[model samples]
Target chain A: MAAKVDHAQFRLVIPSQTRYLNLVTGLAKRASLVAGLDDATAAKVSIAVDEAVTNVILHAYRGEGEHSVELELRFTEQALEIHIWHTGQGIRSDQLVLPDPKEYIKHPRKGGLGLLLMSRFMDEVQFKADEVSGRNECCLIKKIS
Target chain B: MADLSIAVRHIGDVAVILPAGFINAHTVREFEEALEGQVQQGRYKILLNCKDLNYISSAGLGAIMGLIETVRENDGDILLSNLQENVFAIFDTLGFTQLYRVFPEEDQALAAVAPERKA
Candidate 1:
């Protein structure tokens, strides 16, 4: 007999609001559980999702016209993948550099930590900007060992 | 999202605030306002009881730092007590443990902010 393998996926479409951070965090938690990740890994995933969604709500939208963010979570036996999409103005990947928290600690700067946290916590982080479709997509992948 | 519930009490010369909830960006403003309100009133000897605070993000920690600066600028200090392990990790990661004095119990925190100790 062969060991059974299963895959699970979940999606959510939420308005670009700070309150939606909880929704994304909850979804990531569930995906981590489905992927059988450890408690620390699950908490890191949730934090990464929170940071990503917060970037969309805070920087992407710029507190202007309303927009919607779509989150997709896919879990397999080997890995967990998160896809976040927003219809706001896209950001340049080059400008998305991760700041060293230590440097900020010495100087005490405001902002710019969210992206850094996401990049640090996620195993792989990718950004795609499609100006034609007005879509900014961020993908995060974490391997389950 | 953690709902922040703040209770402010004057313990002799020190003002002790108990903050209960998740210390995330969504819930940080209330915490900020509570501290700022006290600072503006010239009540700077402050202690925060964080036993009920389950988690804290960088933003939430930043808010605390901002309040620390505000209070210190006015010749006041802020002490934190009963930090959950998760929240303590955040403070440690940011090197805040070096910047602020933290106590394990509420009484110690309150004592740290006593009027006689004000600088």
Candidate 2:
């Protein structure tokens, strides 16, 4: 599927819990198709969505009571983009700690692949945090074929 | 309802786990419990038939990875078979084929274990 003019946009707001992760993924799947992603690309985009949103659910709340994550899915002619936002502890882009390739292969950690998956499958990835608002956002983009 | 369901069948000494449903952070606990239960029963040779698994996240991957050490320490292996494309992509991206053997068919995974079981 190639890029097209105009895009479809969708939004899903869910509580920051593991159970709600699928809700966001469902939106991402729709966005992928709207972006004209083929089966393979759609699968990657969906998985990328799962990873990005899961990070927010697992890390954003930080013990805060009943926080919600807001997800925005934008399907553009050129890309399928997702913005995951939460008003909790934020990830400073400078402090992004990806798994070390050498060590990861030597001994695959029980966990720690979320960031890697997001970065690998998405073409453009950005992380932002606002100290004043305490907003943590992850924007991931997958280019359409 | 949980997003995932795991049904286990004892095939000789191997535990065949049939997981139906997309697996993610919300549902990985069920998968972990099923695998852990096999470990608890001293049955480490695990074969997962993902014929019905529509999706898998890194967390879901972690659930399986978490149990590998225990299974291997007991001289057993984890074999994966019948993966949907979406689920297989995640496993492939993680280089899981190196950690566990993946078969194109469930019977193949079972066949590989049969020799080991008989020996």
Candidate 3:
């Protein structure tokens, strides 16, 4: 994390534990605000980042032995970009289909909901996974209006 | 992160759950268990008084989704009341406001479920 307010860049690394989710979300909220996003957009970005980080901990590092999740926040002239890196299982966005809330309640699954919310809240979402290198990355962007 | 605190109280047959603090992946288990406890006890008329709840992630919402079917099957429904504006926005964005009934006040929500208790 940089102390330069004008640059507005941040980097955080947390162990793959759910306990640190709040710290990640707090930084996301502050970073989004510092990047000149409004309160509503900042809140959404915070949630998207939280969901992204939560997925890394719960799904990417499932059953893992003390892994770390790397997160980077960059504010560009056009958008606020958040990148998350993990060394566990990768995510397939093609397989993630957002379900209707009414229909979803009938089946009610715990998985995929976080990703679905992330997709809805953020302006752009991209995923890259290297099965051989065990490096998986997800990037979420929210454009500045 | 402030720990999630849940206090369950009864308003006639309705079991009101008051959860305060953030409900992210870390604390979702406690929220889920509290809801489950009410269901297991066969008390299905649940009202979530979220006046003091500051934040809730998808994991928290999933807990409610996981049990809605059974609760409705038993002729009981989970009603939500006193949601903070930010919390309500999350529910609305996910189309939950349409699936579940939400009231501005706890009294209004309880009256909808326990109409007989109305004065």
Candidate 4:
């Protein structure tokens, strides 16, 4: 008999702490399982998901307690999509730059690598900031095939 | 959540520390502490067996870089072996493979640490 597949959605709240990256990683793992992704693909999804959530926690919230972040994961037969929404102040997406490997390795900066990793691992990564809605959204999509 | 564990073993002049599980912010400190303790004891040559290490974050990689600097400042070196492909990708993406001495096996790492002296 073929394995039955069903849609799954999970919502998790992580405090604005670096340690919370683990929580995001775990959630991505679960999402991968639900989406029936292979081991390597699942790992890539996990890394990309963690990077996206970490950006929200670090940049959007800045480890502050005033804002809470929500991670919503959706799984389907075709793909797995993760949405990270935060109530913290929104920043212009165009301002973010992909880390140049040469410059980063030479200087070894602390931040900015998160977005690079996310873009490298995910099939589709989009950042949307809505000032009027008071929420910043980062969407990551990975094909299960 | 991913858990990090460390095991330290001594082999000749080198100390082989195996860190298993995920290397993230929660575990980065412990990882740093383990290496710092070895450095404090004057164990300069170290081999990190990452065969069983399943995951590593940027913070974890940064911790490794910090430890390398710490050990090198005191005339020590660290070699990494058995890096999984996923971990290798992270290293490659961050351009760490160019900076660190990475080996395919523990023996290679140990040999790199203590080269044979010809008679």
| Candidate of highest lDDT | 3
Q: Candidate 1 chain B, which ten residues in sequence have the lowest lDDT sum? A: B110-119
What residue runs in model 3 are displaced by over 4 Å at the alpha carbon? A1-8, A63-65, A105-110, A130-133
lDDT (Cα, tens digit) per residue for candidate 1, span B82-101 = 98765676566556777778
Write down the C-alpha DockQ for each prediction.
0.43, 0.64, 0.62, 0.40
When sorted by lDDT, best at the front, the candidate numbers are 3, 2, 4, 1
Residue pairs of candidate 1 with colliding backbone atoms: none
DockQ for candidate 1, please give it.
0.43
lDDT of 4 by residue, B3-63 (tens): 8889999987788999999887567789888887888889988888999999987767777
lDDT value, residue B50 of candidate 1: 85
lDDT of 3 by residue, B1-119 (tens): 36698999998889999999999999999999999999999999999999999889999998998898899999999999999877888889887888899999999998899999887
Residue A2 CA displacement from its true place in model 4, Å = 28
TM-score of chain B of 3: 0.97
Candidate 2 lDDT over residue span A7-57, tens digit each? 677787887777766766776776677678877777777888888777776
> What TM-score would chain B of candidate 2 score versus the native chain B?
0.92
TM-score for chain A as predicted in candidate 3: 0.85
- Candidate with more favorable, higher TM-score: 1 or 2: 2
Q: Name the regions of candidate 1 deviating beyond 4 angstroms.
A: A1-7, B115-119
Task: Give the poorly placed runs of model 2, Cα more than 4 Å off.
Answer: A1-8, A63-65, B116-119
